[model samples]
Target: MNLRLRSNAIMAVAEQLVVGITFFVLYGVLIRSVGAEQVGILSLVLVLTSVGQLANIGFGSALLRAIPMHEGRGERHLSIASIETSALCSALFYGGLLLIAYYPFQYLITIQAGPQYAPTIAAMMVPATINVFAMGLGAVSTAGLSSIMRNDLRAVANIVGGILCLAIVFLATPRYGVVAGFWALAAQSIFVLLATWLFLYRQLPGLHLIPRRLNRTVMRDLVKVGYKLQLQSLLVMALEPLSRLLIGHFGTLSQVTYFSMAARYVMQMRGIVYSASQPILSAFSYLRESDPARQQQLYATFSTVIGLAAIAMLSATAAAAPFVGELWIGKREPLFEGFAILQSLGWLAVTVILGSYFNAYSLGFLRYNLGSHVVMAVANLVLGVALGWAFGPWGVVVALTISLVLAGLIMGIGNARFQPHGSRFLSLSNMATLALGCAAVGTAVAGYHFVRGYWPMLASGLASGVIWAAVMLPAFAFHSERGLILNLLRLRIKRRG
Candidate 1:
């Protein structure tokens, strides 16, 4: 990546880290106040409502690719129209559809989470449904900002919204239970939605969300590209929510909380890296037709960085799982530790192999991408159902873990087919180093059982860091992308000096 793109990625990562940490703290408060079962209900509500993204019909995904392409060709009007049209359609169409589906949605909660939780889930959905409406407004705005390389502005909006969510959830949960979480969601959505539009309006001379600005042709093309992307993502995105549902169905509400708890921590922590890497989508889209060789070079470097970061982060987190769980909820639970460790490893597979490929898919490889999702979704459903039925929570997690690794490797094979000669997603030596890092971290985590409290946390974390630096840093130092990164760092340091 170039210096400008790298800096944007860093800002994006900072935004995600702050926002993630804010909500993570709120979840901790919820656990202390309302108990794990209530937290489980909240998790289910959030997961169920996430399906509302279908209302946008993939326009958000399309905007990321289409707007950038349109702008590159100097079609500013088309770019403006695309954003306005997507936002307008999402609010008008998605709101009505979600409200109409409220009862069925409640029924889904009843079946998945339990009947007793249905009433609270219903109460929560009232606000969550409204939040869905606002999402229509926010989605295009968010995408527009990123496509324009204004992630710094988007990050500001997100951080402020997160703080608002933390405040609302903190103040209301003790009195209103998990329902408070939905109210907070509604508030945060509206705030961020407004902030994003205001920012876009300021950045783009003629941007507007008014109906008059919505172009029929832009809307049509957005759906043309978006629905296909949305269709592919619908099943792929269900992996986590479905895993939680399985936990709720076969196990208990508390089990759902445990699973989601671990997942929330890992996903949020990893979001920093994911958000950091996201600029590649815009960068790739910008260069897809214009510069194939440069695009390949960027992809190779990014893929390596993603893998190394995933290993370093996930391995350290897995080793410190017990400590994290204790600190997160004010107590230690073995299940939380197991869930964190398992999920860390699972997401590491995703981040390392499949990280930038989804963004690459936006460069027009949906057929290959769709095939990978099919492979993953099928593996998840088959293994998840069979194992979940046999062994309970552990079975569900193990199923997810295996499905991720299996599908990711398959995707890696497909991604390689498109690569330039002598470029690989993961080199054999780096792969070996990654394997060694995992093994070292696993050993450290295993040894944590012999110790207790903060000692294990510190020791395991330090040991993982040491192992990563010794093994992984050398790989980075010798890799092809090292020059780009080192040069960027040196430029920044030189400027400071």
Candidate 2:
């Protein structure tokens, strides 16, 4: 690892940590305040927003690639103008969605909440819908900052967004309860939107935001290019939080609370690696001026570290369950024993880390939509919802884990088939081993649950985590380049040199 790359990695980690902390804290407060039904409503808003996110049609990512690479003032202006036009199209799509949410389509969501809570959820559309649009707007700036590698700015923006969200949720929840949380979510989205737009417009003056005369050719190309991601967005939007709705329907709000907290924590812990990887991958995408082989080799290296990190994080999550739950969730007894959440995190770790690497691969290939992403999204939604309904909240978590793990496995199949060598170059052995290690911990936790009940789940989690850490540290010291501790040593050595 070069010094600059090492610094970039660390900064990315720090950026995500700060963002994650602020983001999850808001979730904690919201969940703590309104209970699970409210949590369900919030979950619905997230689902809808996910759909709304597609309004941009991955234009933000498209912009990130186009802006930095294009040369000359003319090229920059055209690209920025392209993005500006895309934004209007995006706004129209979301505007349409909000209209749907308000009228006949409002029944689609409200009916799910039941008559007692239906009206409240219906009213939530105002903030929630607007929030969705705001987030899409924020994507433009986030994509811009990412292109420039302004990670600190990214972190600051997120902190501001989170704070804004927290304030709205807290203040509104008092007057309107669950609806307030959604309102606050909308507020955060709006804040980010405004900030991002201002930053982007200032940064690129040539790219006027004024509506251009319609270009049918440009629209056709843009939509065609972005269609894959749009489908993926739609599918994931539906599937990701179907679990929450399922839990709300089958189990109590308490169950939803249990699942939500666990999900939030897992995301927070994993965000460090995910966020860190984003810019690195983005930079790699632009490194066509450098060696593509070397670029891939580096991506794999990062992926391996992410793989190991997943193991470490999941292990710790397993180990921390009992004490962590006691402190954070209180004694819900049956509502949260922690094993389900832990297992879910294990699945998510593998899914998310692998997905991150694949994203880079997709960008590199400009094969962003081979249909796999959307397929995975559909699978996750169907499986998650079905399992949640069948087995209750735990069912949802388990289903989610399975879906993610499967998606991770499937990501490489096509790549392996079509690579230059006619064979996959990336090592599956390390990922497989790390995966087995995770499975061992999950199984041990599950077994403990069955045999000694939930207490043993906690104990086993701790034991598995400590054992993995101890085993991994020594093994990694000699065998692995990107082991957590070694990465630090490399960073230090580079600084000295």
Best by TM-score: 1
Give TM-scores for every candidate, taking all chains together and pairing residue i with residue i.
Answer: 0.91, 0.80
What is candidate 1's lDDT per residue for 1-497, written digit by digit as tens? 12257678778988988877877787888888888988888888887566876678888888888876776566888888888888888777787887788878778887777677767877887898878778767887898899877898999998899889889988898789878888987898899999989999998887753545667888888888888788776866688888988888779888889888898888887787778877777776766645656666666666666766677777777767766787787777888989988888877777776444744465576666667677777888888889999999899999888877776676677766655443344567567657766776666665555555446556654654454456456666665555645543432210010
In Å, residue 481's CA in model 2 sits off its true spot by 3.7
Candidate 2, 1-497: lDDT as tens digits: 12255555566677667656665666666667776667765665566776677677766656555543442122555556556666777677767766765555457666666678677777777777777778876776677666555555666667788777777766776667777777777777777777766666666666555545344655565566566555555555555466667776777756766776666666666666666566554455444333456555555455556556556665555544544554465443445545345454545534434534444443545343344555566666777678766787777667666665555555555444423332222346455555555555555544444443445545644654555465445444454344444653363212111
Model 1 Cα RMSD, 1 decimal = 3.6
lDDT of 1 at 106: 77
**Cα-lDDT of candidate 2:** 0.58
